[model samples]
Target: MLLDEASIRRESEHVEDHIKRWMTVEGHFRILTALSTQMTQDAISVAKTSPLVSELYGRLLTGSALLQLAQSPIDRVQCSLDHSGTAGTLLADVWPGPCVRGRVEHAQSTQAPLYGGDGNIHVSRQPARGGELYQSVSPMHASSVAGALQHFTMESEQVITFISLATVVDDDGQVTMSGGLFVQALPGMTDEDLSKIKGCLAQAEFEDLVVAGDHPFDASAAIFNDVDWIETGTDPILYRCRCSKQAAVGAVRTLSSDELAAVRAGATETVTCEFCGTDYIVSAVDLDAS
Candidate 1:
């Protein structure tokens, strides 16, 4: 039961009001916060069941949603983090609906620390079923998820992208709250407009906004002051695992009987879903019959 929910909403009246307040204005731009209960559920399940592997991947997934949202002008983006030091690879696929699905490779049940000194972070854009796919590669920074993304945007895209992420770990060291925000300077946007947006974001203080769980989070983007209130969209992001018993069965079907026997002979005949840390047991007898 993985959750994959996404929504998109806008603030027309708010934007209008802001436009009236600020003399300097530009075209409409969006501000988005993707706080996903499904993400929390999935992360917690993976962390609790497999502490060592789920934490980093969970944050990467949550952060990917924010990155996708930042690219409102772009249709789709794929973010992948490869940490060669300690933590494994993390992949996130994001689309216009701001919908996201992600997974961690080589997960385990114990908590292990990861260092991100010399790893690679990749961001790419691949539109619906037709358009060409474009990608950029950047190096990870200080081993922080948000920091890595900041580097990617600043270095690769030449766009000033600001981001902040926070994930609450319960007493058992499992993820409870996984959410973040991403703000970027839109293309063709005037320097004045960009400066104003940057000033406002600095005033809001991304870390404070994200870490302050008690306060009501606000995505009030005050950019276009001259335009009328047009419309609003919602993108309620969620956690969803693309793993299924049938898929597992299909995968198993590919293995020869001897290979199956070899796998069964190895203790713990379990097939762990790398995406969500859900394990499927395949008894030796079952494998023999199949």
Candidate 2:
């Protein structure tokens, strides 16, 4: 599963809709995410470097982000799952600005034995700059995180969404293609329109979709049907961070100069951004001003 730039560009064009976009179609759209994981000896394998499990976790987060965006229009959200059943918990965050960042706690182990266990999924919303965050949790029923998320949406949010996510990584550890779709039923929507939505979802080239590795696949005509729908445009989603060295310096400034000196001398002042894997280091000179 070797991921290619062209294929990614194609997929990035329209296969999935983000939170901001989902909000625009509040009354008519639904979310859908699925994956193409093949099992070996009863254990699922992603065929890529980053386990398929991690990708599924991400899709779930993406769906949660969209759902949260619809409910809390002003704030950005982050969804996390503590499926300690397998690995440690999984975390994912997305902003209305449409920014996304996430990762796994322990992604190395091949498998974590859990004959049959349930897990928890949490959704949190934090303000634009900063403010009190809100959270909601639900129990997982299926082995697949996506399935559990769908259940959560239905039971908690009372929204009907369908997600289809797939990941095809090769033996070489390259993710040939990975993406999903989110389609929801709008209130007061007609059955004919709903049927059209289903038709589009069904017509999708699932096999070529994952193998083709198209990100932004077209959903304009397929999902919308006769219902009045609009393209929310591309709110490019990516792995990012909101940390800075200057911010770190400002924090050191709050401390006494002596404290700054100690931190610099130890060369122990480090700020790491969980979203983008960026590390900011505070050096002796940096603390001298303090």
Candidate 3:
């Protein structure tokens, strides 16, 4: 599939969460990355997470955005950490498109070990126009959230792939730098070619590059110096929660008519978004209508 420039997550001021996508000139591989900042801080803040939880949250956000390349811009991809660990279940339910939101089942318990020790990375995708859902799961036994995501993609695609994720937090527990790298071997690429690309990337100090002066995309040239590269385009990834009073009312409408009447008699009901913890008040007028 062609990586159309029009699909770049742009035309918005919320450009803090952004990524750059590229492919080898010989079409041997696909790569995506960025040294993200505000987006990470803003996104993890949605859950008021602890330092331990922040790093994993950052990786999920970055991994999810980079993974969007596997589908069209109009499609949707959701990544969730399904585990019974101390952190409970964490979800990065978004792409670089319209809404990039996340949820923490238990904010206070989000400090559990990555993947809760026996969890799996669950991925789901569907057409924006509405169609059958495509889902996949891979064991999350790796050392990092990035590893788990990479494991899922490689196993799901049954292809050679490389993924690296970095999250740096300061003494104050602030997200200093957040980023991810995804490299997938495309058809026709020789084993030697893939080896060369991997070698060059392996030698590059990924964590350092993530905080280097230049944008990770521009700085990537130093790592791929021996190989020619082509740019598909760049797009922003912002943390945007899709919630509102109207949505709350619609949710309330899902109840039985009798239940709705009982709720309306209360005059108002509070709807708190599990994703962002934003509260919306549903008035009797809203429930009484229609």
Q: Could you give candidate 3's per-residue lDDT for residues 16-96 as a string of tens digits? A: 556777899889887777656677788877778777777778777777777775444666788898876666777887743
Judging by lDDT, tell me the better candidate of 2 and 3: 3
**lDDT comparing candidate 3 with the true structure:** 0.73
Candidate 2 residue runs with Cα over 4 Å from true position: 1-27, 30-49, 68-74, 112-116, 190-232, 250-261, 264-268, 275-278, 288-290
TM-score-superior candidate, 1 or 3: 3
Q: What is the lDDT of residue 186 in candidate 2?
A: 70
Question: Each model's TM-score, in the order given?
Answer: 0.64, 0.68, 0.85
Q: For residue 277, give model 2's deviation from the true position in Å.
A: 4.8
- In Å, residue 231's CA in model 2 sits off its true spot by 3.1
| Candidate 2 RMSD to the correct structure | 6.9
Q: Once model 1 is optimally superposed onto the true structure by TM-score, how far is the C-alpha of residue 275 displaced, in angstroms?
A: 1.5
Name the runs in model 1 displaced over 4 angstroms: 1-25, 49-58, 69-78, 84-88, 93-113, 124-136, 174-176, 214-216, 219-231, 253-272, 279-290
> C-alpha displacement of 184 in model 2, angstroms?
2.0
Clashes (N, CA, C under 3 Å) per candidate: 13, 33, 1
